[model samples]
Target: MPTSSSSPPTDSPTTGGHRFHALRVVIPALIILVWLAGAGIGGPYFGKVSEVSSNDSTAFLPTSAEATTVQNRLPDFLGEDAIPAIVLITSQQKLDSADLADIRTLAQDLAGLPEVAGAVSPPIPSEDGLAVQIFVPLDADSEVDAAVEALRAELAATLPGGLTSYVTGPAGFAGDLVEAFGGIDGLLLLVAVIAVFLILVVVYRSPLLPIIVLVTSTFALCVALLTVWWLAKAGIVLLSGQTQGILFILVIGAATDYALLYVSRYRETLRDHDTRWAATKAAWRGSIAAITASGGTVIAGLLCLLLSDLQSNRSLGPIASIGIVFAMASALTLLPSLLMAFGRSAFWPRRPQPIGDDVDPQVAHLPARGVWARLPRYVARHARPIWIVVTLALLAGTLGLTQLEAKGVPQSDLVLGSSEARDGQAALGQHFPGGSGSPAYVIADEGELQDVTDALLGTEGVASVAVTAADSPSGTAPVTADGVQPIGPPGTPAPDPTVDDGDVLLQATLAYPADSAAAEDVIRQLRSDLGDRAAIGGPTATDLDSNNASIRDRTLIIPIVLLVILVILMLLLRAVVAPVLLIGTVVLSFAATLGISALVFDHVFDLPGADPAVPLFGFVFLVALGIDYNIFLMTRVREEALHHGAREGMNRGLAITGGVITSAGLVLAATFAALAVIPIMFLLQLAFIVAFGVLIDTLLVRSVLVPALGHELGRHLWWPSRRIAAASDPAPAAVRADTADR
Candidate 1:
């Protein structure tokens, strides 16, 4: 029989009970104060994340990647590491002499800006004569967003009455990305906090309890940010807007989820014990295993990203693992202290009353009349049918997985709301070579430069090609089948191509938009033809390489994460069958989540497509998080199984853990769903997949499927473990009748 233990009697001075009592109050108070100080110090670091974070795609490529090599050599060939911004000037009619002169004056004015590199190109007239384009290079080392804004301001103020100008190209697109991520620190955090507070308030139905849980979550986030910020500053990890947003959400959701579990145990302990300290100790003891195991499982899964070839993926592993560590610490240490301080008053109007010692442990600890209590009885009666039907339903949902198209989304479609760069790219494509401004760069030996140029020109999407020449006025001498062309009047001598370490740079302008599928296909063809002889990179090639790296990371990391999590579950459960069963159900839940998300993304939302990393991220979060609810239930079930028989213990475990795990799941889901407000396509997709998947796992898999299957299997579910006695006899008729009525 499981017995409730009381605190040491404080009146006995000889027994040292007085000393133990003093330490309880003193230790909890000190823990609370330390967390408060940490939160105060760490809170301000959230706004400073931009100082250490980067969104530059090229920075994330593998060192061995061709794109990374080409990107490194760009400065030597182009004179400066500058991102080009194309200014498109258009008029309703053909430009008159005055309009042409005004455009030239505007271009010259743009060249005077401090952020402008080298020289601004002279206005080049379009074939229709209705528009003129100027290429402006902005120093990549400067504040790109500010420079782009200044250029836009100058163009807006100086453009002639009939001409309209737009800043587009690499720098322009990078500026747009910077602006899109600007709200991550402020808006994302605010929305997540408010969403979590509201959900916690409804779940606890108490004012003070929700605030305590929120404080635990927020303090964990602040501390995590403080740690990650310094790590990024020290150049140990790469920080990006995407990674920062995920870190914030992961910390808050995970902390609150763990807190909810502890709170549930603490509240239950309060009902059985008279003293707050005794209840605190009991709750902490009961909840620590599940909380730590659940947290460790998530951390292990995240750390698996360390094996990823992409730096961005690798960076998230340690960054998020750090967040999980703080989340677990806050839940086990800070939250318990806060709860101990408040005691039963944290429940306010609905505070639980202490039960007499003679009361039944099962009746006092587990709800006997709620929905959770009734659910176990229903599963007990229709165990096999329930598992079979739910399994079939989940399997049917997997059919939609075939509709998933996670190849990758175009860079232009990355930001969900209206994007100036996307609009500019469209306009730029209409008037110039579709890949104007952003060209595919090729670096090869000087002797093979002409051969590489010939290969580029022969490629179907190549509209034009040029060789970087130090002596040329525009820095590039146009390349033709005949070789480099002169820049001056007819018969002028062609400039010699620039050479560094016997390698030369060749720029190929494509006939398709740089971010379009057509351009990616062209770059792929070029890569296939050039092989190791030439290195190719640009905005298009960067996208291609990133997509491929993400695909590779997914393939390599997914299985490793599954295996890591399986090992953790086995060690935690002390049984092979239960861990395997839990893993299988979580995987099934992930597949169903992806399938539903695919159908919703394709048919309902009408999205362009998903990023390749989306599935990998979705799997990592869903599987690790989905297994959390099962861990909570099964750990409790195993504890009860040690006292009662396996059949009775499974019923009691489901009845007691059902409400708390469901509440935790709802809290986690709401926090993740809050990510949708950010308007980033990847965040939005990941938000839905995880949010929906958690609810499914909580309500269906944990509540129905696992419990039902376990009930049917009885002690066999814990096979090979002598801890549970295998019951070969059938359950009593009276027990079945009593369960049916309840």
Candidate 2:
């Protein structure tokens, strides 16, 4: 074990060394300036993402989905595109004709709003005579949240005193989603940044070092955003509010994790090399493989989402992969340069003391102490038991997966906090048909309009049917067995249905809420009965397809992701057995996370359910990131094993890398935990699963399970290594006895 010496080494610089010193300083300065310029260019893109991004679910559905097809062809048959808002007004007393006139006047007023597109329908009284419902269509391209706000404000001021008003429909839900995601750009970023900063501050205990690491992370995020923003603007890819929020957190967490590894290497390397440039180069050499491999593993896992049938999942593949690329690049390039430029002063009050100059920087390294040192000793003593206990514990947690209900949550539950739309949904269901305003749309051949109408009317949950009529006073005509009914007096002729190419649109009013399971069942039944005759779409169908697509994606992509990561690990460590064990461990960890999350979500938080995509996203992040920690550990272990032998190397690697990796995991967990601040159920659940899994991987799995398992396997862990047999030896007796020694 190498102990620190008080005497410092003399600086005997050669003429050439002195000459190149200026060049070395100049190179780092240049790198810093270039990164600064990029950061400056990308900083403002944070606010501009909303310009090219959307919260519209339909726009991000798989192109092959029936809902997507219906959405695309809707403007053709309807003559315009719009989001529908349902206005429900209820009074304690039965309404008279005067009340009906006032409701009609209010509908007219709503039609005059700039955000309202086409026409507002006349109020239809419920059978109870105490409530009325009206449809107000809004321009889909405009700021819908603002439009909804304005409409609510209008209702507050204009509606008669006896009536209570609510806006509830697809448009209302969209507005709620927008409001929930409104915090992504500013508040979410602020919370994540603050959480990361606090963790870094605690981990480094040096004000300046944490700042440098944070700057590297922030710059990476800025550049990633700058690139992704332009890509989205060019329409090369799609962006959503959820994706945008995830990008912010992913870039920051990944970049910071990479930076932490580099910082650890740089701090340790500084002990041997007196020159800042030499220390920077040596540290880069020490950490680059692990950093790059870890980043690549995550990128590969994220890219597996490209196989997803859901467009949202597919888009996340490229978007998050871009984030990871920048994370690696910035850590490798910017962080080293920053550390080199700052020199030892970056550590501030507790600067690392350099070893004597004559020592070889490659072989000379610092010893490990504290719990990190002691824990490795424990693993070395009881290797088999340690791994067995941890594995059983993890497997036990996996048993909770049976409680996971990942079928898909109700639309009303998507936003986590208070919601007017959710309340309005309840109100609407209490009076008129539960699926008011958001009707299932059927697009079929104009020739089959009658047949489609009859089939829809015959459907179990369907309450009524209507066909779009270009000449109708209200833009739609009721359809009965006789035919399309006149919109006006009995003597008037029926309005002709709108025809686009050879297709016509039929709207089916459902007896159940559009987002209800019963409604989804209705859509499924309709699709079955009307096979090839008509395409069924709308809120219920969209949810059904999105959920089904998510299920398919997870089933297909999870296994592929595991294989991709396994191959990456094999290449990274040049070992097949270790990679397999690591993958199995991480997969076990993910299952445990899901199991525990299920318990917490249902028993603790009382969440209704989860989007089917939750498990898939959770698997992608936990497995990729769980493997990331192991990569850092094993890469260091392999490096040490080359000289010290496998048993000794595993112990030394765990002691040295454990603290930094734990710090990195904590930073990542904190950043993800910040997502809970945003009032969306998906982000909240994702935050918990990933954050908790990271901590589990960090403090337990990577710390004890992997090291103990590696200790048990010894040289066999590094299969195919040329010096396989020699790799099993333990550290010299003197070092092993010291307990605190490296």
Candidate 3:
């Protein structure tokens, strides 16, 4: 083993390295100026928005005869286009005449609203009926959003007696989601600033340095967020609300980290010389490789999201990758200039040390020599058993994934408790033999055809069906020059007119509510039952399809990302054997994170298993961040190997880098812990899982197992690299020269 000889840099205090620091500040100021100018000018665009416009008359026409023409010929058509927005009925008992009058008034108000296309009341039994179903057809321009708001406002108004009304639907859900995210922007701004401020204060131990680091990091974060938004607006990327939250956390946390890693090292070098220029150079030289490697691995990991089929996950990958890239650039360029401007005063109250530089009291007693020097030997003896146990436990818990049911959570689950809408659903379900909310189909065909209606009435899931006169809203007669009109009008035995080229229309309603298990099952059966006779179209059908697609994408994408990371790590480490073990350990750490998250949500938090998307996101983030620790530890291991033989190098490397890596891991974990404070459960799960993954990665994978294996493998660890035998082969000037003769 080797020992210190290069003066430990900190043993001799000096004032130097200020020139490079000054340049760092000036360059960043200029860059900020450029960014501000670009922002003011509306940034850049690949193409104008006007390029995507359409001029076809049929595109916007609500009553396209061609659409109706095709609809009549289809085996099924669930007039999803004209489907009424769902409405809830609320009352404590069967609605009295007065209750009915208020409801009618409310319904009339909705009908008269500019956006409402039509309205209807579903026939509901009066026996023990506290609720009734009201259907409102959103006007052609209204869509889901307008209907939810209009109905919500109407419900909020004081009603007759003690009755209460609430609305829930696609529109209502959109409103709720918007409300949930109301103050998130402000909260994120406050949290990020505070977090960066606190971290800088602790690391630099100076008020001004913290402020500087905070400002630079915050600027970098702002640029990243604006970039994400620009990309989203330009259609180069897609980001949901959750993705926005992730972008906020990752940008600030990572940017701050880069600044800390560089600045802290810069401060350490300041103690060695009086010249700021030399100190800056030394810090840059010593820190650049570590920063590059750490940031590179993180960016690489995040980029793995590009392989994902999920648009959300895919978008996160590049956004995070871009953030880390900017952070690295700022650390190397912007941070140095800022440091030179501040000089030794950046340390604030802490006086210049004669023998030590910028040392934190928290790690003042951390081992620098002796029995602790043989940290790798300790790791070697215990690594296998500990690794094995943890691996088995994680693998065992992964079995739960097999049991993971992948389906989209209904909009109902988006709200808390049995909300007014849910109670309304319960009421509707009770009063109606079959839930009144069942999706209805409008089958259209050319020529009057009573036979189509007869066929639908005979179908298995079909309840009582109703159809209205097929008249064009524009007052174009339903009959064209060829005398065409749609199939039947309920009890009317009119001959079905040709929707277009030998087709007719028939309406069918299911015997179950849209959200019920029976409804979904009935839809499947209806599809099979109708065969090629109809085309299904409804929100329920669309929701089911989208849910399945999301599940399928998540199922396939996560494992592919892990496999890619394994291969990348293999090439980076230049060890086929080590990569496999490394991947296994990472997998264990990830599973442990999930298991703990499960425990928290299921037992501690006393909530149900997390929403479906939570697990997928947790998996991606844990794996990506977990690899950061491995890269940190492994890079140090490789550096030490080039200096001391494999055995001594492993121990010395662990001893030297362990504390810093642990500190970083804790800081990163705490950053994730901030997510737990968010109000949403999905974010809470993300926080716990990521925090747990980092802890396991730091303690189990990097600290104990990697060093243990390094010792166990010895020179074989660096196979094919003949330079492995060279005792100062790739010596890092500061640490290696000191430990060279150990």
Candidate 4:
């Protein structure tokens, strides 16, 4: 096995080398200045994201979905773009005439609010007479959160004594969603940056180095967001609060990870090279392939979302891919420049001194004696046993995968923290039909309107059915077995049903909460019964369609992502066996992550349930990002193995790469963990899954299992490749002279 020599080689600087040396200082300075200007320009866009982004669930549905079709036709039926807010006023005692009068006054006052789209519904007493429900239509395009808050404040100030009120419906949910994501721009970014900074500080034990790394990541995120914001503004892609938050974290974590790899190479090169320019050149060469391959793999996996049936997933593909592009660019350019400018001082008190340049041999060539050193020895000594035990343990964890319930969760439970919308949903179910404000919308041929209405009314979960009417005072006329009912007195003429393109709209109030599983089941049954004859849509249908689409996306995209990543790995490692081995370990790590997360979610946190997309996203992130560490480790191993035999290379590679890879893992894990503070269930679940998966990948799979398995396989690990023989071949004259000197 090749070992480090006491002597070092002198560079014979040609004219090209001299020109390259001059360019390094000038080029890095230019790169740093450009990034600083970009960060300054892009940082303020964080607060303006809401201007270009949406949280509306309906907007994210597939265009072909029933919900999307209904959503598009809604404005035509209603005469305006609006979202209903159901206000439930409840009292322990039956309301008297004065109470009814007060409720009427409250409704009248709500109608006067600027955001109120039309006349607010008069108080309609429940069958028990202890509760009254009022429907308020708020302009969907307005500031929904502010409008909801206004409604809540007005109700609180003017409600009759001993009565409780809640604002719950589509608008209410939108308001809650906006509130839940309110922290994405500030708290999420702050938490992620702080977490990464702390981890970097611990790893590097340097003040300036962590800042430099963080600046690189922050600059990448700022530029990515700036580009994404404009793209969203131009309507090229849908930007939601969910995607924005994810982009922020993905950029920061990925950039920092890439920065860590570069830093490690730079530090190693500094120990050998006296000049910062030479060290930077060598480090950039060593790190570029691994970093580029890792970033490309993640981008490819994310872009696979374009094939998803859900717009939310499809939009995230390009949005996050853009972020990854910036991350890679910044890591390859900006971070390198920063580290080169700082040079050895970037390591501070622990700065690496050049070997054999007035340094003690004992201090310079001190053999690694930490856990990193011992870990390689352990892997070499017990290769088979270690891999077998780790594999068995990972497989055992997969058993818990069956316990994961990822069909979907109720919209009321979408936000983990306290929510007025969720509370109002509970109150709404208690007083009136659970789907009072939000009704299941159906569009059918005018000829079959009555038939579709009958089908909907006959459905088990349907409370009442009404048809959109042009002349009705309330915008909808009641639908009965006979026909559309009169809006007012018996003598009043029945309003004609609204018709557009020979289709009439029907609204069916659900007997259960609009976001409940029972409502979704009813929607599914209706779709099954009606087929393409009628398009059924609403909040319930939207959830149902989204869940179905997510399931489909998981089935289709997961395999494609795996295949794409495997090919990238093959090209990267230049060997079939090594890439397959790396991919297998990452897959096992992902399963273990999900399995353990399933147990934790079900038993520990006791979450209601997860979105169907959770597992799919977890798999994509874990496998792609998890494979990142393996790529870092294995690429170095392959490089070392080409000089030293496979066994010796594995030992040296694991030992040398251990600390940086672990730190990178921790940094990535910490940035993801910051998602927990967002207060949204999907993000929270994703945070845990990816964060846990990364830790498992770094600590167990990459650190122990992979190295052990590679050692067990020996040179055959590079099957079909005779590159392993290069370790035994004599060096060329130039290399021999360099080796003799070094």
TM-score of each: 0.96, 0.96, 0.76, 0.94
Question: 1-742 in candidate 4: lDDT tens per residue?
Answer: 0022354433322246767867766898999999988888898999899999988998899989878988899888878788899898999999999999989898899899888997677788998888999989998888789889999999999887899998989999999989899999999999999999999999889989999999999999999998998999999999998999899999999999999999988887877676677777888898999998899999999999999999999999999999999999999999888887877777888987667535654234224588986777667777788999999999999999999999999999988879988898887788789899889999999999889988888889999999998678778889988889997877998899999989999999999999999998899899999998899889999999899999999999999999999999888888899889888888888888899999999999899889999998888888989988998998888887887767767877888889999999999999999999999999999999999999999999999999888878888888867887545533333333433453
lDDT of 2 by residue, 1-742 (tens): 1233454522222247665867887887898898899999999998888789988888878899999999898988776589999999999999999999999999999999999998888898999998999999999888888889888999999998888999889889999999899998889989998899888888889999989998999999999999999999999889998998888899999999999999999888777666676678789998888988899999999999999999899999999999999999999999998888778889988787676546665445524457875788878877788899999999999888999999998899999879999999998988888898899999989999999899988889999999999888778999998889998877999999999889889999999999999999999999999999999888899999999998999899999999999998888888889999999989888989999999999999999889999999999999999999999999988887887788878877888888999999999999989889999999999999999999999999999999888878778888877654463575434334554452
In the predicted model 1, the residue pairs found to clash are none
Ranking by TM-score: 1, 2, 4, 3
Candidate 4 Cα errors over 4 Å, as ranges:
1-22, 357-367, 726-742
When summed lDDT is taken over every stretch of 10 residues in candidate 3, the lowest stretch is: 49-58
Query: What local distance difference test score does each model get?
Result: 0.88, 0.88, 0.58, 0.87
Report the lDDT tens digits of candidate 3 across residue range 203-259: 556778777676666566666666666676677866555666676677666666666
Q: Give all candidate RMSDs, comma-separated.
A: 2.4, 2.6, 7.8, 4.6
Q: Among all windows of ten consecutive residues in candidate 2, which has the lowest summed lDDT?
A: 1-10
Q: Tens digit of lDDT per residue, candidate 1, span 1-742? A: 2223344312111234777878877998999989989899999998788889888889999887888989998998888778899999888899988999989998999999999987788888888888888999998888778889999999999998977788888888888888878878888888889988988889889999999999999999988899999999999999998899899999999999999999999888777666677778889999999999999999999999999999999999999999999999999999999988887788988986676557776678877687986888888888888999999999999999999999988888888888777887888777889998899999999999889999999999999999999888778899999989999999999999999999999999999988888999999999999888899999899989889999999999999999999999889888888899999999998999899999999999899889999999999999998988999999999998877767777888999999989998998898899888887899999999999999999999999999888987788788767787445224645446767665
| Residue 58 lDDT (model 4) | 89
Cα error, candidate 3, residue 655 (Å) = 3.3
